[model samples]
Target chain A: MKLPRRRPASPKKTAVGGSPEATRAALLQAATAVFVASGYEQARVRDIAERAGANVAAINYHFGSKEALYLEVLRRQASERIERYPLPDPAQSATPEAALQAALTMLLSRLLADDQRGFVPKLLMRELLAPSAALPAMVQDVIAPQFRQLSAVVTALLGPRADAATIQRCTFSLVSQCMFYLFARPLVQTLAPQTYDDGAVARLSAHIAQFSLGALRAQRELLERADA
Target chain B: MKLPRRRPASPKKTAVGGSPEATRAALLQAATAVFVASGYEQARVRDIAERAGANVAAINYHFGSKEALYLEVLRRQASERIERYPLPDPAQSATPEAALQAALTMLLSRLLADDQRGFVPKLLMRELLAPSAALPAMVQDVIAPQFRQLSAVVTALLGPRADAATIQRCTFSLVSQCMFYLFARPLVQTLAPQTYDDGAVARLSAHIAQFSLGALRAQRELLERADA
Candidate 1:
């Protein structure tokens, strides 16, 4: 269902001067905070506008609608993080194993970095847990490419002998080990307090990398033996 | 913080007659539906009582408060599922490999069961995502024992040479693989439909078991080499 087309009855003056770019940027920033604090369903355009210091009509003027604004917020945050923490070129590492470690470390750095970009993980996780109209598009446009990249790395690590299904499961196992920290932060903090401490990102990435490398190498050996 | 003390000013006649056990059972049944539907914060005592056909006073008399009632619901559902799907005795399996697979199957069965007992997983997941007052106790009383059981199986597989931290990480890796299906069902359904279909529990159990076994065996070999 489309959100009601809410054109403010009377458009108010721009709070951040008459710069459309500034207004749009401010709206996106405010929208991120509002969306993160209260998920998609509960987030109010009025709140987003007020926080942005832009009029409600400014949201419609800049992003067309709240859903569109939300999509932009999600898309921008994802791209920004990927740009900041892009996967290492396979050639950069000594071996596929090192490449895998680099890839996992990069992914974990994105997922676990406790910094200003923190809102992105929280926002994405909210979308995952209680999905909104934006989920399908977000998965296809944003998540699928990242998933495919990781799959390619897994395929390389598993070698040509591994079946397609096996490659996919291995890819998921690697990703899940990383994503679980995002999905179950509270549980992890409660159960393994040390694992969730300041060194969590490094410690978890190393552990997942080693653990997954073992699984991948073993599976490769098994497939090789079967072929022989 | 304690829930405010609320005693119905006028205790009405019991809906399912004067039998305390009958009223209590009805209240529990109704409360599960309400809690599962609305979650802990939004669920109303009046609605639970009305659905049970009992008076509000019955809730107070039986459960003491809404928080207590919610805890009882969580506690009972957990115990019931565990009773219904207890982990296999380690002695029954020929090896730790078999035991690990058996344990994974048991866990996936409980997590993925598509039957009347569905409310428990949904309820438990809700608690995990948006924790309430009952979470710490639930983790301790319900989840920790199961975690310890899985830890034992993992330790048996990893061997005595591995350090405590390595064992803990490996245990979490195994669990995170199984739980990814639950926590990210929508993503799984969207990304790989086959993995979440009718045969999901079996397929997932097999994949996680094989993958985790490979990792465990590899770690064991690595540990052995280190000792040598």
Candidate 2:
């Protein structure tokens, strides 16, 4: 049987070499892999260009610098996947739990599905540990907006009294719950040598959603308890 | 005040210029910085040695290969920190929440205290994002045993009814809660701009402890709810 075609690439960039834009897109695809493998500081433009099947000068021509290219790769990876897997339709259901779970499911599914998408988390983790000079810009342009949106969604579900600090903490907790699998894979596999396959990913996704729901529910309960 | 005297050269590797062991230690230290800055694939033995104030031959003479040196750096960092910060004494607490909170506090304190100790999370994150040839050894020797020990502690606290999967999920949640601050500092700072200092770290520590306790407590409640 033919495998399902992967999700369509985000409208932002299409196939490489199809046009001038495609060549830039191709350079980004190649750069993501190289940066994920070697990291931004060590990833060479020559290798990225070669991987993209473009001239060495193509990277500079398209992105101006290796740093610029790396930032672009981060943006493309984060923004495109998020857009492709749009947040759950809020109109579907009224409960906060339902909306929260749908949003989380979308996020987790994207994280676990695409192989090329693996580089995004890896790249972000690297920058987090040892931020490059470009990190501020990347965070401001790409990461901050996504997080702000997530916090807003979570806060709305949580209601007005949730407070900015509580909302921020909850957002961190939700993202961290999802990210543990990707960021701590080696350790997880080592700790429970039995559980690293597709089966495990399914279980993990379910558990994360359940765990998050429980936490969110508890927060709501606590608020009710306090008011009572 | 005079800076606390650097730990006198340990007998394990005196600072004598010509000793093979000293050369090996120096190379590892240098490699840690290089790897932290440039990451594994892009870090060079020459640059590492230069950072260590040693000759390039020092790496080849002691470690035999760059990959070996990288692995050794990770090993040394993990082992040294583990040795320095002994696990919390289990006898200090009776409740599972108390025991786990104690452990979490110790782990997070070490992870965020200062640059020297903080490097463990940074280095581990880099490897997680981009596994190199050396990653398996690094994980086995450094990450696994600690996680296994922590998992056991968590299992005991959660009780026998908690299956391996439940315990593992909880462990991942607990760790992610602890490590998230260090791993997501830039993003946190960018989004929350005003709250990224010691005050935030204090809030994070308290929040993680509470969050983790709530999750673990919920596990027990879930088991109770199922039985009822």
Candidate 3:
């Protein structure tokens, strides 16, 4: 059952060399597909190995177990998102508003942009709904850092003295605006097919930035008024 | 494997009498669970019927097939949400601002409220991700109408003269905030475990309402300034 298939390991021939590195890369790609499709309990290790045109022993040798292989897919996916759409360094923008806008733009790109691991959102979303052991790593390694980054920009935009809860809520609000595009893709595709297009993403970025900044400024004024 | 169990349908005995209505209800309950867990493709009629303490023929007798049963769950789930948390009647609010806030409140409540059928979000979420046959009914019967209603509130808040795109974007922004509380529940739970609690829901509700309204009002003022 673990025999390598004569056919290519997918269209890209990710396992071209059949070397350990190539086999590991091939396994990650195949494991991601299988995991996203069948989830944790149902996904079979043999299927993943077959998809990668490698032996099951390779999965054990390289990743130790199926859980470790799944974790690698997630970790790689998280890093790739940052690499592909790095948040505009907070300092790069000339003003607080620009910084926020830049962040939103990059975020929209990261969420909307599809790469090799396009299934990451669905994979993570499943875990979110029905948490497994992975929920902690996802929160700590990926989500926590991203939320903090957004919170910092939001705090700067709202003024340094913004209360913690308010900053957190604001951060959640801003991230959700971008996240909805990816998270609710199926429903959006069914109802409004045009939203995922690049043009739409760009437009959405502008609207969210302006709308968020607009709201923050308004909230600031209201707070100041109450203070006065 | 599809044999009818002789048990009394323990617990509520949703199918106690084996009456058509009771059987149907029982099937819906059990189907909701299986479908939410395994999705459309993976869910089996035998599992659902057994869970509901009925037989396979009862599924055929009551809902026609697994697909029909799944569709009924979505339709009922959709209607139940509207019934449980109907959008605030438009006339009750003296102003558009109040109308939008009320609507946001309703949406958050609908999203966050867990009842006898707390699995609705997860069920709908899986469909939204993979989207088998039920996507159309979900969009048409549930999601679209709600969006139009929110768009109307956004239009009123932005003033009747606001263009279509701005209103649409604003509506998406507002809905995403609430949906995030539901959509990103896993991540939210991991980081801000307080969000789902009653106190957090109320506070978050207030924050989203004000944040959205504040942004709209600020945008209104900016538009006016530009016009002047």
Candidate 4:
């Protein structure tokens, strides 16, 4: 949830850089919204401050500059979302299917989460679609590791004998299915509104898992046939 | 290919409304470039004119207004791209697997064709991510029909016993795999540059086809087991 809007630092407060943590939190929230809506190239510092109900001086004092503020927003949102729906360790599950399902459940829940107008995925997706200086670090720090973990889970499902290309395609296929749900939410909402109801995401996730396991089983058959 | 830039109305030619068909084509081409790069709201009419090497009046003359021009660009690009890589009729294929593969081959080819910066898919994706007035008509006229055809192919592969939900998820899984390549191209390029090389897409497409087939077969086994 948004911190109380407009918690501007008062001069009566401690010296510069002494703004309450709430004000700092508020600024990051507003920056995510502004950047997602207008993009980095077009977003203005004053607009972020206005939306946050904080003053430009507060932004300057806390984050140092607009670019610094944008990076902070990216880092904060990524860390928070990852925190909220943390990936389950495969060891926590009994089977690869269960592990994969757990990973997907966390992912779908994050993508479908509309809390704070879905600021987390929106800001992250905007960066992916339209990159900024922040993107390299974002990919390296957040995305790459998330992908590697998912890749490991996928490879586990495919078993040790699966070739690299086969593993890569299977991994990509599963991720793409999940990404489609997030990336095409607007279109899907119009096309299939019922998909968003209570427990609907879990149902959808179940279907994708079944769909994928089915495909993997079939692919294993083909590989076996080729080997024979 | 982009029409010659800035083919202004020659004074030696006819009067205002007498803009040639070539000019109209150029306007449509230029409009797509501008719209994709800047989006509909931020796109400027004057910018399209400069790119087309035509005057602003030529836009009004050929397409009536900015909204009209945008619509024309959407329609023209959709029609041309569809024309370039037309979907095959299912009747021509001998089996469901072949039919499904044919459909996916066309779809992925269209998505991966980077000629002209892969303009068609990029423009259409930008619209889908950020839909406008043109989106509904675009979906109705262009997208919905394509989906329906693909759905039919998927349903056939699913067999007559498959229910609507099963068929829908299967269809979506197949499409999501292809759409992922188009949508997350930048990320994929960074992550797996090998995927973009000659024959690489064909290999990817073959993997998706096998993956879907595997999943479908596995799903069938589940259904049979449940029945037993």
Model 3 segments more than 4 A misplaced: A1-27, A30-72, B1-15, B41-44, B199-201
lDDT tens string, model 3, A1-228?
355644444334335344568888888889988887777667999999888878889999999998889888878777776676655678777988888888788777766766664656666677676677877876776567677778888888777557888888889999999989888877767656777776866788999999999899977877667767
TM-score of 2: 0.77
Per-residue lDDT of B1-228 in model 3, one digit per residue for the tens?
A: 454433444344345444567777778889888887777778899999888878889888888877888888778877877777777777789988788777877777777777745566777777766667777777787678778889888887887557777787888899899899888887777667777776656788789889998999877777667767
Q: Which tens-of-lDDT digit does each residue in A1-228 have in candidate 4?
A: 443333343343222233468678778878888887776667898888877767789899988989888877766677777777776787889988898888777767777777656666666566666666767776676556667777888878766677987777788887888888877766666666777788966987898888987777677667777777
**Candidate number with the higher DockQ (2 or 3):** 3
What DockQ, between 0 and 1, does each candidate earn? 0.45, 0.46, 0.60, 0.59
lDDT at residue B166 of model 2 (Cα atoms):
86
Q: Which residue pairs does candidate 2 place in steric collision? A: none
Q: Under CAPRI classification, how is model 4 graded? A: medium
lDDT of 1 by residue, A61-174 (tens): 888888899889888887787788876787788888888888888888888897754777777776776677877877786567768878888999999998989998999999
Top-scoring candidate (DockQ): 3
Model 2: per-residue Cα lDDT over B89-148, one tens digit each: 766778766777777777777667675846776777776776666667777766565566
Off by over 4 Å in 1: A1-23, A53-65, B1-76
Clash tally, candidates in order: 0, 0, 0, 9
Q: For candidate 4, write residues B1-120 as lDDT tens digits.
A: 543333454443222223477677767778888987877777999988877767889888888899998877778777878888888999999998898888888889888887766776
Off by over 4 Å in 2: A1-79, A89-91, A115-117, A140-142, A156-161, A192-196, A199-202, A220-228, B1-29, B115-117, B193-196, B199-202
